[model samples]
Target: MTLPRYAYLGPAGTFTEAALRVMAPEGTAEHLPMVDVPSALGAVRSGEADYAVVAIENSVEGGVTATLDTLAEGEPLVILGEVVLSISFELVARPGTRIEDVARVSAHSHGLNQCRRWIAENLPGALQVPASSNAAAAVALADGSAEFDAALAPPGIGESLGLEVLVSGVSDRASSMTRFVRIGRPGELPEPTGADKTTLVVHLPSDRSGALLQMLEQFSARGVNLSRIESRPRGDRPGEYSFSMDAMGHVAEARVAEALIGLKRTCPVVLFLGSYPAFHGEVTPVEPETTDESFAEATAWVAALRDGRA
Candidate 1:
């Protein structure tokens, strides 16, 4: 009977809030709006919320470094699921203000990047002022605390907050989308959906030339395809780096499990973020040699050979 609590980057009308709505809907869960992504995730880590929804990647900006770095360290949270939302922005300003009157625009860093070309072509003279979030920028404008004249905010935020929409559909790429994940304290993983993704953070055993290749081969040899991969500076040393990757299969699958085992033996640090349902729901095609049956048969064969049964 108690509603689940969800902490997200928000002041109400943010893309993260929208993603949370997609997962929990209005009145279904308690929404706790944090000032930023780290705070949102921190709320979950502190047991202040049941889950946290934050953006991990954007089509235009690629990986969201804040989310990646935060998830890579800390108390260890697992992704429960993901939501990918098509991104679109609205140029909003005070009711009496016009586009030409805007001298400055405020938006989150990623928002600014996605709308960079549009902003350049349309608001050529406007200076970009980065805010913690698009919704925060809108909130600042609405509350008369903003130094910027306009904000690049999610669609509908202008109307909801009593701002004027100077221009709609503001984005360099029409197909731009951001991927958000629902994160929670590590616990029982979701049942393996055929269409799933397993996320991980791996630190190479050494800085040697072949170390990276060896780490990647664990998945490659097991027929586990990687959907996304990025290297982040380990920060402990200048030459060291860690990889954050999304492998295109559930950890429950044989190929994925074997690949993880190989990484455990080779990599110095292998962090299993989680195995969750892919937002797109596209099932990864498994090769015949990598099927669960094949793995079982191979194991049996190895056991038979050990027992001299051939």
Candidate 2:
């Protein structure tokens, strides 16, 4: 049997790698480390890997623009599932280096932002240097190639890489967590678990007033709820924007399907990213009138009326 290949942001020890491990344990699949998120997804698109795992959102940073933009426009891919990991960083430095000796620190942009307050209060004088990833920063520090004296990396990684942990539990928010998705070429979607989420990218028909409301009403009228919705500039036009959303139901559900149909008729571009199992496995509560039975009965009523039997 051939082992599956997974491309993830790496050099090992990144949060994305941890997420991949949650999905596919070590020795079960081949892990390909990419320099960045785009490259990881690209590997999947080019058939270099079976799946790509990348971060989509963080509690403190909100949406990861790179992941959002890359998924919005690309050879179609679908999310297979998601993993949510609590985030905490460790200030790692050369062995015997004290925290006060650190003049510069390196981390990914999101990592820097997440630890901004912590860094301010603790390492007040340290300059922030950006790295491709926190793991990459740790790697640079370990290999003697880093310009920074210390690196903010995932917990346990510093020890694994033979670096000294100067300070642990570094983060502004105690409850910060990152959401990662497993992406693959579109094919059979995961079976509709009652607790599931459907992701999409929608371009509004126009930038006129009430246009945003018009787009949102598709889901509202159908009793579907949105768990997350963020707007990104279309880039083609100044005022134009596209929305990336995670609706709180599976596409296989009647309410979700009808809402999608409504968007298809109104929105100029509606991209269905995928419907996958929600990380927490909490089922979305359906309104009495929006149940599958109700939708089926409504469809039968319409057909009866058309046949002049009602």
Candidate 3:
């Protein structure tokens, strides 16, 4: 089987790695470990990988700016599918080291900050060292490259590097989840699943005061529900902002297509951020089964064996 090439930040273990592990099984993916979020997206835009995934938002830390920035760049890539990963962080140690033995904590800047309240009370004297990647911090400990006794990393990564979990689910909030998206060339639009999502990076026309309202009205008029929307500076552009929006229905759907076309009229310009099959949108009692061809081939071999030895 020719698995889709996947890219994410890596040195071995991290939440992104954990997310990828559950989002797509091994052998079904070829991992690309980028130095940062932007670089991960670059891997897909430059044809380096079949698809790229990056953390966009986290329940604890809020937004991941780097991921949003790259998404706003809007190269030839499009959103193929989204994976919402339940993130559980662990404070790790080399071995036989208790939590009290730790004098300092190292982690990705944001990762450290997200667990700020807990760290403040439990390890008050410990210094905070923010690195580029959380897994890289773990690597530092395993290789004795970092002087700190422990660092925070995704459970999967910490375990992978032969580290012990000193603290579990340290996020101030439990059940925290980070969202990731799989991106590919725009031309390679994912097939319609009837269940789909549309994400748009839009810059409204300055001349209009109710530009955003009007954009929402378009979707509202179509009776389409907006799943998510985020506003970020367009590189801190003077008097300009970029809005990233997600809405129900596939971009190819007549109602969605009409809404997008109407939305364009409200903005000076809008970039389609790849409308693909939506995942993790609705909350229900049962998780919808994935119908991706490879999944079927693996589990429904008889159904997949159509003309073969059946």
Candidate 4:
């Protein structure tokens, strides 16, 4: 069978690139390489692609802005699954290039920040240019063909861009991870893997006191855990904000269904995105270029610590 195409935030080999790979290891996945998260969703909604995978949140950065905005688009583009990948970023450039010669390091803001310590410490004279996507920045370095070469990106991205690894595993925090979601048309939801989470965005009745609190209470009353909640400015009315929530229950679940009904009653609008599987992948980090017995030992140590087996 011909596999479905995935519209992701990439040209190829972004962290988003890795998320798509995890979600559909056997399927024929194609990169949509959108300008932003919104454009990627539009691809899924308009049938330009079968699905859109977006980074919803990061461990340190909280909620992703474009992903939050795109979640407001309602149906035909529902979040079906969430996959979390550990982010161990790397610095890359054409081989034989030195850090002193590197002038501008182009990368997605998040990627650059992950490697800020390395950049700030090593290339004090170089400027950090913010690009939209990690892969996008790598693409710029590849296409620009200028002295403006170095970028902090996923190793997969550097490989795809024909760039060489300059510095490996540069993120300040070792446990850093980004959560991504798979969005697709309603009723066409994928089979529920044990690991999954759903996303929702709501606009409460303007100034309805405790309306937000009430919905959350219902979830709490039912023992549903909320993974994330962020407020976006309700542009229609200045100073007011809308709630974007990422919770641990699916619409298919009875509690989630009840919560939605209660939410609709309290809020003026309740947007239901997809309820797909969450990433069950091992949180293992791979440094660029070098890998050995020590790598396996370190990963095992992290796993042991996570499981309280240490």
Question: Over the stretch 1-310, how does candidate 2's per-residue lDDT look in tens digits?
Answer: 8999999999799999999999998789899999999999999999999999999999999999999999988799889999999999999999999999999999999999999999999989889999999999999999999999999999998998899999999999999999999999999999988999999999999879898899999999999999999999987778678999999999999999999999999999999999999999998999999989999999999999999999
Whole-model lDDT per candidate: 0.94, 0.95, 0.77, 0.74
State the local distance difference test value for candidate 3.
0.77
What TM-score, to 2 decimals, does candidate 2 have? 0.98
On TM-score, who's better, 2 or 4? 2
Q: What is the C-alpha RMSD, rounded to one decimal, of candidate 1?
A: 0.9
RMSD of each: 0.9, 0.9, 10.6, 13.2
Candidate with better TM-score, 1 vs 3: 1
User: What does the lDDT read for residue 114 in candidate 3?
Assistant: 79
Clashing pairs in 3: none
Please give the clash total of every predicted structure, in order: 0, 0, 0, 8
Off by over 4 Å in 2: none
* TM-score to native of every candidate shown: 0.98, 0.98, 0.83, 0.80
Per-residue lDDT over 26-87 for candidate 1, one digit per residue giving the tens place of the 0 to 100 score:
88999999988899989999999999999999998899999999999889999999999999
Order the candidates by lDDT, highest first: 2, 1, 3, 4
Position 264, candidate 3: lDDT = 79
